[model samples]
Structures are given as C-alpha cells and as structure tokens.
Target: MTAARVGVVTFPGTLDDQDAARAVRLAGGEAVPLWHADHDLKGVDAVFLPGGFSYGDYLRCGAISRFAPLMDELIPAARAGLPVLGTCNGFQILCEAHLLPGALTRNASLHYVCRDQRVAVESASTAWTGDFTVGQEIVLPVKHGEGRYVASEETLDALEANGQIVFRYAGGNPNGAMRDIAGISNEAGNVVGLMPHPEHAVEDLVGAPSTDGRGFFTSILSKLVNA
Candidate 1:
C-alpha cells in the first residue's frame, strides 16, 4: 500500500510546520506541505494544523487563520471524516472554526508559558491518541500565552459526559485551564486539538527521555494504514 500522505499546513508566521512534517515522515507517512492560501488539500489522507503565531497572532492566535482560504475546504473535509490534528495555535484555529468547542484565554498569570509538561491521556478513542492507554502519562512541550481554556459550566459538563476531554495536565496546572484540560476531541473523534507541541517531543535526541509524542503520529498512520 502507498504511504499515507499527511498534509501539514503552513500559514504566514507558522513556526512548526517543518517539525510536524518531519514527525510525519518519521512515522512512516508522506509529508505534504500545504499552503494557507491554497484551496486544495492535495489528496492527503490526513491533515495537521501545526502550532505557530499565524498572522503574527494579530487579533488572536488563530482568529485570522480560521478565515484562510484553505480552511474553507479543510473544515468541510475534516467534518467528512478526514483526520485533522491541531496543536497549540492550530488548536486555536480549531476552536475558531468551531470544529472543537471552548475558547482559549490568556493565562491566569498573564504571561507566556513554555515548559515540559505532563499530561494524562483521558481517552484513547481519537485517531491521534489510540496508541496511548487510558490514564497514560506523556510529556510534551507547551508554549503559549492564551492557552487557558474556558467554557460555560454546561459545555464543560457536556464535554465530560461525552468523554471528549482527551488530555489533562497530570501535575499542577500550567496555564490554569479549567479542570486542567489540555486537549479535547470532537464527537466523532477524527478531529483533535491540543495545547501542547507533540512534534517537538518526537525525537529522543531532542526532547524528554521517552518518545511518547511519536505515538500520536504513529497512531494516526496506523489507523489510515489499517483502513
């Protein structure tokens, strides 16, 4: 079978598309570079919206990015069962696109936070998280200011009931996200959005002792390969 082609989108000011592409290649998939202005998805099997200060984080991290021409097709494609993973600023785009729920606000401390953080896998049902066991702990890096996630009590309750909360900070909360929520998934589980930088943790030589983040890429690749 041909290797699954994973599209990594690069918007103006995007900082991690290259890293995401490298991780995709390392996971045995083809990395297809996607421009923000392109209308086509280029026949990729899956897509990743990498973290970055797109549009220089002008109005908000992903506010401007959500309106990009590519998203006009990408959003519908994702809703049609195409696997889409959004990290950090990408996560912000997901929220902005309404593909995922909740809004990210400035950190409670009012400062940009960057660090190696521990997060518990709250669910293993998503395309990007199937390799992890429920309650598994993984280390990844998170860098952002408007990383704190907030929602109404009703929405929080709905997310908890549906098991859409995918990851939670295992130790102390880094950005004061409500209930330590670090990541979440859509109801179908094909789309996932997280505040951490998994691409940064894929290499053993560069990141923490364990290559926990590699599972995210491998999990999606395995799913596509099996399908």
Candidate 2:
C-alpha cells in the first residue's frame, strides 16, 4: 500500500514537530515536513499542527500562528474537508484560527500541568478517531500551562447536541475544562483538536507502555486507507 502523506507543520516555536512526524511514520504513513511560513500544503493527504508556544504565545497561545501564511491555505482546506489534527498548543491554534470552536484558557489552578491522563472516546466517527470504539479509554502524556477548554453555554449545548465532543477526560478532570472535555471534532469530522500529546505515547520504551496514543495515528491512517 502506498503510505498516505501526512504533513507535520512546524511553526516558529513548535516543540513537537519531529515527534509528530515520527508518530505518522509509526502509523505507516509518509511523514511530510511542512513549514508554517510556506503557502503550500505540499499536497499531503493529512495535516498535523504540533504543539508548542508558537510566537512565544504572545498575547495568547496560537494567537499569532493563526496568521502564518500556511494557515491561509490550511483554514480553507480544513473547511473543504481535509483532515487536520491539532494537539495541545496546536489545538489552541485551531481554535484561534476558528477551525474548531471553543477557547483554551489558563488552568483553573493556574499551574503548568504535566501528567499521563486518560480520556474517553465520546465519538468515533471523526477522521482521526475511528480506530477506537466509542467510550474507549486512552492514556497519553499531557503537558501544558493553558489547557482549559471553555465555550459559551449555547455553544456548549450545540456541541453536545451535534455530538461534536470527541474526547472527555476520564476519572478526574486535570484542567477544569468545561465538562472535562479533552478533545473535539468539527461537524464534518475532518478536523480535530485535543490537548493531550498522543504522538509522545506511541512507543513503549520511551514513554507510556500502554500504546494508547498509537491508535490516534493508526485511526487516521485507517480512515485514509479505507476512504
């Protein structure tokens, strides 16, 4: 099978670009490196916005990266049904770019948090989450200072009504996100944003041995293959 070319975009301050690329390779996809400043998406089958304090998180996390030249193409591609995954700070960029709804804010405790967290798959229909059954639990490393997800009550209700909530923190909430939400997908299921670093958990030797994060990459690959 020809591997799907998955683009891992690197912004000015991106910290997880290489890890994200490795994850894509582990998932049997061709990992394509992309630059934030580039206007082209390189004709990749999928895109991943890795985590980091882009633009030094000036004013806000992902606030500046949203204006990068790549985003001009990415935003339209995402809206046109291209698959895009955003992790942690990347999630912030998606929200800032308006690709995904809701806003990520400082942790209620105002602390930079790092831990292995569990999240339940609330919906399996998205392009990035089809590998897990609904309600499946996955453990992954989460390290961030501002990971709390918030939205207006009306938007919250709409997300629930439309079944857009893709993942919810299990057991206990780590960041005080509304409803313990850890991830979400757009109505089209092509775009997803989450706060956990699934790319970091793909291997057993370096990080968690549970292999919870591998499914994230595999799921997306499977979806692309089957499509």
Candidate 3:
C-alpha cells in the first residue's frame, strides 16, 4: 500500500520544516514538501506547520504568515477535517488563522526559553495525539521567546468541558499559560497546535532527549490509514 503522505510546510525562515518531515518519514509516512507561496496542498493526507520566524516575525508571530498564499487553501481544508498540526510559531499561525483558539504571547520571564519540557497528555482523542493516553507525560523540546498561551476564562472552561485541551505542562508551568495549557485542539479535534517541538524529540540516536515525539506523526498516520 502507498504510505500516508504528510505535507510539511515551509514559510520563509521556517527552521523546522525538515525536522518535521523527518519525523513523518520515521513514522512510516511520506513527507511532502510544501512552500508558503504554493496555492495548493498537493493532495496530501495531512498538513504540518513547522516552527520558525515566518515573515521574519516582523508582525506578531504568525500575523503575516496568516495571509500566506498556501494558507488560503489550508484554512478551508483544515476545517473540512484534513488533520493539521503546528508547533511554536506554527501554533501562533494556527491561532491567527482562527483554526485554533487562544494566542501565544511573550513568556512571562521576558526571555527566550529552550529546554526539554515534560507535557502531560490531557486529551488523546485528537488526530495528532491518539497514540498517547490521558495523563501520560512525554518530554519534548520547547524553544521560544513568546510561548505563553492566553485565552478567555469562558473559552478555557469550554475547552475543558469539551475535552479540547490536549497537553498541559507536567513539572510546572513553563510560560504561565492559562491552566498550564501546553497544547489544544479545535472543537472538532482535527486541528491541533502546541508550544513544544515534537519534531525535535522523535529521534534519540542523535542525542535527542526523548523519542516520545514520534507518536504525533504515527498517530496521524494511523488515523489516515484507518480513514
């Protein structure tokens, strides 16, 4: 059978596109390279927005990248259940596109943070997290200056009630995100965005801190295979 094809998007300054693609490949899927300027999705099974300073971060995080030509096609596809995932700056773009809720602001410390972060899976029902179980803690790398997630109290409560909250900081709140939210899914659970870089932790041979991140790719591949 043909392997699941996952699209890894590259915006200008997108530093993690290759890493994300490698994770998909390692998870037994085919990684398809996508450019920000491309107007089509190339018929991939799922889409991944990798982390980086898109548009030089001239505007607030993903504000500019939100208008990328590719996003014009992506937004609707994601809404139609294409299964999309994002990390760090990719998470910011997902919010700007309104594909996911909440916004990532500057870390409370007012400094960039880079470290191995332990995140507990709060909801494994989403496409990208199905391999995990509730309360399972996985370590992934996080590197960002603006990583604090903020949303309205009502929104947070609703997310909690609907099981849309995906991951939460395990050891401690790394960025003062509301309710310690590290990641979340949309109402339908097809789209997900997180502050940590799962792509960075999928390989341990290169001295990566953990191989836990590989599950994100595998989870989505499983979903595609069964769909």
Q: Pick the candidate with the highest lDDT.
A: 1
- Model 2 residue runs over 4 Å out of place are none
RMSD for each of the candidates: 0.7, 0.8, 0.8
Q: Tens digits of per-residue lDDT for model 1 on 1-227?
A: 89999999999999999999999999999999999999999999999999989999899779999999999999999999999999999999999999999999999999999999999999999999989999899999989999999989999999999999999998879999998999999999999999999999999799675678899999999999998
Relative to the true structure, candidate 3 reaches a TM of 0.98
For every model shown, what is its TM-score relative to the native structure?
0.98, 0.98, 0.98
Name every residue pair that clashes in candidate 3.
none
Order the candidates by lDDT, highest first. 1, 3, 2
Q: Write the per-residue lDDT of candidate 2 for residues 200-219, one digit (tens) a residue.
A: 99887876656788888998
What's model 2's overall lDDT? Answer: 0.93
Residue 115 in model 3: lDDT: 91
96-194: candidate 3 lDDT, tens digit per residue: 999998899999989899899999999999999989999899999889999999999999999999999999998988888999999999999999999
Candidate 3: misplaced stretches above 4 Å? Answer: none
Model 2, position 116: C-alpha lDDT score? 90
Question: lDDT per prediction?
Answer: 0.95, 0.93, 0.93
Name every residue pair that clashes in candidate 1. Answer: none
What TM-score number comes out for model 1?
Answer: 0.98
